[model samples]
Target: MSGCYIHIPFCAQKCSYCDFHFSTNHSYQNEMVEALCTELKIRSESWKDEEFQTIYFGGGTPSVLTSGQLQKLIGQVKSGYRVSNQVEITLECNPDDCSTENLTTWKKLGVNRLSIGIQSFNDEQLKWMNRSHSAADGLNAVRNAKQTGFDELSLDLMYGLPNMTAEEWKSQLLQVIALNPEHISAYCLTVEQRTALSKWVKEGKLTVSSNEQQSEQFELLVSTLKEAGYEQYEISNFARNEHYSKHNTAYWQGVKYLGIGPSAHGYNGKERYWNQANNKAYMTALKQGNLPETIEILSSFDRFNETLMIGLRTKWGVSKLQLFEDISPDKEWFKIVKDYEDQQLLIETPESIVLTEAGRLLADGIAAELFIIN
Candidate 1:
């Protein structure tokens, strides 16, 4: 259950809301591709015995890369690592890049899944978000992918925007449902520091939605998607017929994986590693035969806290037996769990601790509250 994640840090246009590491400058695109392959080979020794079940092309925008570049990268993966016969290859595409030609080429190259970033289908909202594509582009992208024989389609939808109404949020979900994608990842928009959205917040140019509104929208998302026959597998992910993102699911379950490219993070069972976020620095390091990465050794407390934090965010929940594998739960930890259980915020079954819908709204906070200090 190992996965490979390749980060392509090139974006044609930087969205105002984005704070992720990416550059609008693509002058070194060719060099970056070569550097990525070089890095892949450099790190391949760690997982030589294991086969990668999934390979994800995530980004700034993977769709910005050409067909030749994609083939080169995928080709590199096939040759460098032990791959599975039915490897799930996913590419995160922007709507404008999901043309018929692009989709067809991707299909031929064994790219089975398309995770299109259709943040919102409203033209006004798209402009507000400074997205590259129009609402029409998004609709056609899904149609194009389906026509090209791609069945495993996952669409990204953003909710919790500034001053959003329940009805408006409902409309967005309905639009996504009409597209009939195999998976839907709906996220709440947060104003991150240094982002334009954050600037707007500081200057009072935009007002964020109320907590009550956000809660209503989330509840609405759960109900509407459930009615549409999509299972809310994770807090933000809905899937039809269990078309889970193999790479991300493996991550939640604490499976080891390699993260290739600048700003990408990787994990074995015990340690975590992250590459340099700067593109030039990363390329320079690889060119000089040096790895531009930092490594962290996880303490027992770190492991226990992570297990509970990530495990509680999904429908599968945290296994009760595995909770104490790293360290003993302190008195306050037991008290917190008991309180949440009594409030019906979470369930304490014989085998697992699963969050109820109400509890999931406060999941991260609850997980932190229950963390044990070493």
Candidate 2:
């Protein structure tokens, strides 16, 4: 099924580890909102006949917007697109921004899921990450959201931080389990270039955890979450009672979706497009009745590589028959697959091929090894 994503590119402050396209200067909020609606209207024609099964409000921080602004944007989408009655609408919120009143208002506005950014349960870690909220704020936010009847709650957790011990990581996971969220997205902290974290590491002011430590933490995460009755649906995502993130699931499944707002990316079956990351440029282009996006036509090889790359990381692995037919017709590819299976890195059933737990640790490398180079 198809989905829609709206990127809200406004944050009160930048985090040390964040490299997403967002601005601290929110002076252009009203202009950005209007521009977003205008862009939505212009792009709605393409997906007019298709019904959207999910809508996601991801961002710099979607919680920064007021209820009125949220209502206006949601209304614009509703009027323009054929959204399903049972559509799963999710909003990414920060701990400090969540309140009982706000949660209730969001529920009233048709937001069924809340993905809270509670990166850590330790105040010290929060400060190190430059998060706006404290540990207490995070706990309170989850309590408030739960009290407001949000059964579909997701929490973001980070591990592999510098100087973070295994005990600390376990404590964080235990605290999250105690909160009883429907979904948990645990990510290993990577130092991307141009981020403050990268700068600090470069200056020897901060030391990232060793790869061995990171791998150990990842194993702990999987084992602990599995014991807590959460299914590891994806490499980084754990869900209870099959309450996976539909929007993200659709994305990994290669479903076509429309991405609205600055710096958003959209994918149809054959082509992909990304909006300009600059806020001023995005607004200016929309105001001038032009769509500010760059489009790329995907070759068959591109699609095949993407399918293999994404599919191997999920619980539902790539279909063996389909992969053999669509991606590689040569016996050499089959030989490579057989070798991985022999090494116990890949599990091959009659229908599909999936990575074993050991293989998942080297998933990217394996996917690259299996890539068809011309």
**lDDT: which candidate is best?**
2
Q: For residue 166, give model 2's deviation from the true position in Å.
A: 1.1
**Clash pairs of candidate 1?**
none
lDDT tens string, model 2, 197-218? 9999999999999999999999
The Cα RMSD in angstroms, rounded to one decimal, for candidate 2 relative to the true structure is 1.1
Clashing pairs in 2: none
- Model 1 gets an lDDT of 0.91
Regions more than 4 Å wrong, model 2: 321-326
TM-score of 1: 0.98
RMSD of each: 1.1, 1.1
- TM-score of every prediction relative to native: 0.98, 0.98
